[model samples]
Target: MSRTSRTRLRLVGALTGALLAVVAADPAAQAHCDDPPTLADLAQRHGRYFGSATDNPELTDTAYTKILGSEFDMITPGNGMKWYATEPQQGVFDWTAGDAIVDLARAHHQKVRAHTLVWHSQLPGWLTGKEWTADALRAVLKKHIQTEVRHYRGKVYSWDVVNEAFNEDGTYRETVFYKTLGPGYIADALRWAHQADPKAKLYLNDYNIEAVGPKSDAYYGLAKELKAQGVPLDGVGLQAHLALQYGYPTTLEDNLRRFARLGLDTALTEVDVRMLLPATEEKLAQQADWYRDMTEACLAVRRCVGITIWDHNVG
Candidate 1:
């Protein structure tokens, strides 16, 4: 067999092992999975980290806290680090909520993946309610990226510098930044983020790119272009927010491998397998299989660094 075939077989075997391990898990240790290898343990065995998205309000629940601390070694703030949450008013910043989550991560010896320096959604009224020239908006965006990224500079493991910047058809979404600054906004956001936190890995995150299609192709082209220009683009985050009805992205592992070939680290940034109402046991088992498959895919790739479930409590 060729080297490629051997690697493929190894990946398949790893996936099968993961599934069997899940199937054999003791029911009594289901909450924390004390008997089976936790996701973090499995990831660590492959020199990767496992993480989950979380919010401040959920931090107050003891049960939630215990599971989060025990099951994962990294945390992504679901909202507290977004543009609106970090900078509620222009020229003013608030780190209260984001800091709280960071504190929690530190206490648990978990690294934080500070999410989202620039996104079209969750914009504060101060910036969105007004109109401005391209130059003015550029300044605002730079300051926001610099301030937020600098604040969490050393504390974060990575930053989703630009989130969902592309449409499903492989076109750039005409968000305020894109309209004002053109596609250059992506490169600029990445540069500013690197300036602020030189050590933190920067990523462009999006959904529906788990498969080899137009959307994933767009990211591939952009990543190559960014690398050519010496941009500090470090990774691509595939938000695998899948649904059972849609079936699995069969090309997920291949997609990740292609991105890794660009000398970029790949991660499942936000993963959840949702189903229609009244989810049956069959659906639940399917979801579990997907979880195992995703984990296996990440472990299979050398440049695939980690996996982060969207949030802890999603069904």
Candidate 2:
């Protein structure tokens, strides 16, 4: 069998038990793709990184850990590296959870894609409890970004410096950062993170921006503006959280191409195709096709880095 056919068969096997049973019926199928090429392997062949988000709790499960270690070339902590977990109290940092994952990735010879230095959600209670002057909030934001980035400097491959900053209609989300620090906070946060870790790639990540529309247009405009201003921005991350019910973003490849044209690396970060309740065989088949299509899309673009599943198992 051809490598491409084997890849398709393994992808089917990984997604559906029924498909796996069918493949098992043929000894040649098992021998050809016995140890299927992991997403990481296929991505690496195209000079990209393939990864997934994992929580610390799942790390304790041996089966889960084994799959994570062997099957991926990169890893992102789902929540351990967030502001609430890392710096629950102001000026005091706890590296326990994030460190554990980083160490695991190291043991597995995998790169770490540190998530979310600055985000509207998962912030510490101390930060959200009070109203503050622009100056005070700016200082707080700067400290958080710098401290977090510096702690993980040289260890992580990239950082989602800012996440979900814009809304569906290309308007800025009125988070505390925007409300207090103004729209320039995005640029400010990116600069601060770069200052802390000059080597790590910085990204602005968001969802609903997979197609060439308002939300994506906002990012394209902002990315160009930032680059012109000599901002230390490196990439844009698309949280391709698709649902079979909602359908796939057909213009996803074109959208990624536009970002690459801006001299920015693009990635399908936090990807998952979820469907309602009990999944049918047809839904599973559709889901598998979506996964294959996304991988092919990334491979087609030179600057497209890789795809990271939101979690290990797709439900």
Candidate 3:
């Protein structure tokens, strides 16, 4: 499928139809911070991009736009645009909220990175039925990618075409995508999405791949193999779902450098350093420093694209 044909097969619609109520901060809701740095502002100072995935459907408020104005160059709507969320039932597609996110990004002159195209989680109940076969599943996957990517066309900067596909042992996870479509699923997804929007970047995103261990090695090796085989994969997404309890990776820089050496672009997809309980003032500032260091690491590597904070309200 040529990109031109795929673009022509797409459908665009007005997002104003699914209007949502404006969110109001509770009068008693504690202000997290007296003044927090806007994503754009942080990006400009650090010489990198900063952004987040908002949990809003209507997008009627000024939050996303405000972040864009502050220096954030990207916006990902998270699960709001996932497979199940967008088209829960077979053949019934909805693009109201997704369209709003892209439109808002365009209005702000910011880039929009689509959260994901395929994943084991958040799959609709219908797609996971008993009679699901490889052929039937392949058709569904291709159609979904073509439709979604074509709808956005040149709007989306990149798509996480395949998320979390490997386990700790360097073997493929038993996800429906892998189980139904086999290991070729990843390559097939990239090809389809690339055919849909050739100019847009495509990435493979996953968590727990930030360390220089079995998991990270598996991902690094897989990415190298894919690129070597001429896969249309354009980039890699490091979810960076960090935890304070286990402590951060000691060889974080080494892991990132290894991936960058694979000759593919990389981005910090879901960056949030979380503790068990509410964050303290000290923890917030410490987390910010960690974030600064993470951005510094990205800047150090030529292939490290940018850093995207999953959320701005660290406090």
Candidate 4:
């Protein structure tokens, strides 16, 4: 292989290691950084990036924008690209929200992780208002996925093609697409997305899959099946929305390694160490430790590409 290819492979193996804790001890939400070596700065040294999710509304606030643009290299559109916002009315597309955030990211020289092409929630009324035959639903689903993917084709770095497809128990979610189109909808969604934008990395994004459990096992089985069939799937998004009450899932590293063995990149996609309202110092310290542990696990895996924090605010 050429030198360029070798370097590229090295980066691919070197772990972009998305540290969602881009919100850190330096106070991620704080307007100005009094300290040198920002999280993005450090991550850049290792061919990695830390990211935060920002909505269209948050762009105008100078304080938020200051931290957002300067701290994180990868920006995730929190609600702009979801089904309800992008295509509120059937065939009547609105790019106002999604485009604004993307434009902001571009001005700052940051890449975009376009969220959620297909998901159960946040769908428009046209889609969930009434029932339809399998063929009609499939057509609608395809048009939505392809149109949105094509519009953002060259702009985005990755697309969360299918989001939250399984329940906590590893059962297929009986979503509109699933109930009508059945389990094959996921493979079809990934395939259609690849056709629209072959270069964009496709991912199956979900929560409660940060560890080796029923939900993640469901994804593992599906990923194996898709890879075997030569479907265009690139990675899995583990929304590591950890809670202080439930305790951290200690099996996360092993879980990431298993996905790496599948030849797929993994990410702590929508991470936040949530806790009860009475934020105690003890709990806060534990949260910080949890974030650190999670980052170390992803860094340990070669195929772990990136992480995006669910919320950008710091305590």
The alpha-carbon lDDT assigned to residue 287 of candidate 2 equals 80
Please list the C-alpha lDDT of all candidates, in the order they appear: 0.83, 0.82, 0.71, 0.81
State in Å the error of residue 53, model 1: 0.7
lDDT leaderboard ranking: 1, 2, 4, 3
Candidate 1 local lDDT, 196-265, one digit each (tens): 9899999999989999999999999999999999999999999888888998999999999999888999
Question: How many clashes does each candidate structure show, in the order listed?
Answer: 0, 0, 4, 1
| lDDT for residue 249 in candidate 4, whole number 0-100 | 92
TM-score of candidate 1 on Cα atoms, chains taken together? 0.89
Relative to the unseen true structure, what is the C-alpha lDDT of residue 115 in candidate 3, on a scale of 0 to 100? 74
Candidate 3 has its poorest 10 consecutive residues by lDDT at 7-16
Best by lDDT: 1
Compared with the true structure, what per-residue lDDT tens digits does model 2 show for residues 1-315?
001111122343443332234445667656655566665654565577878788888877887788788778899888888899988998899999999999999999999989888888988999999998999988988998899899999999999999999999999999998998888998999899989989999999998889899999999999999999999999999988877889889999999999999999999888777777596888877888887677767767889987777767421
* Every model: Cα RMSD to truth: 7.8, 6.7, 11.8, 8.9
Model 1 residue runs over 4 Å out of place are 1-37
Error of 2 at 310 (Å): 0.8
* Candidate 4 off by > 4 Å: 1-35
**lDDT of candidate 4 over 229-278, digit per residue (tens):** 99999999998877889989999999999999999999887777777768
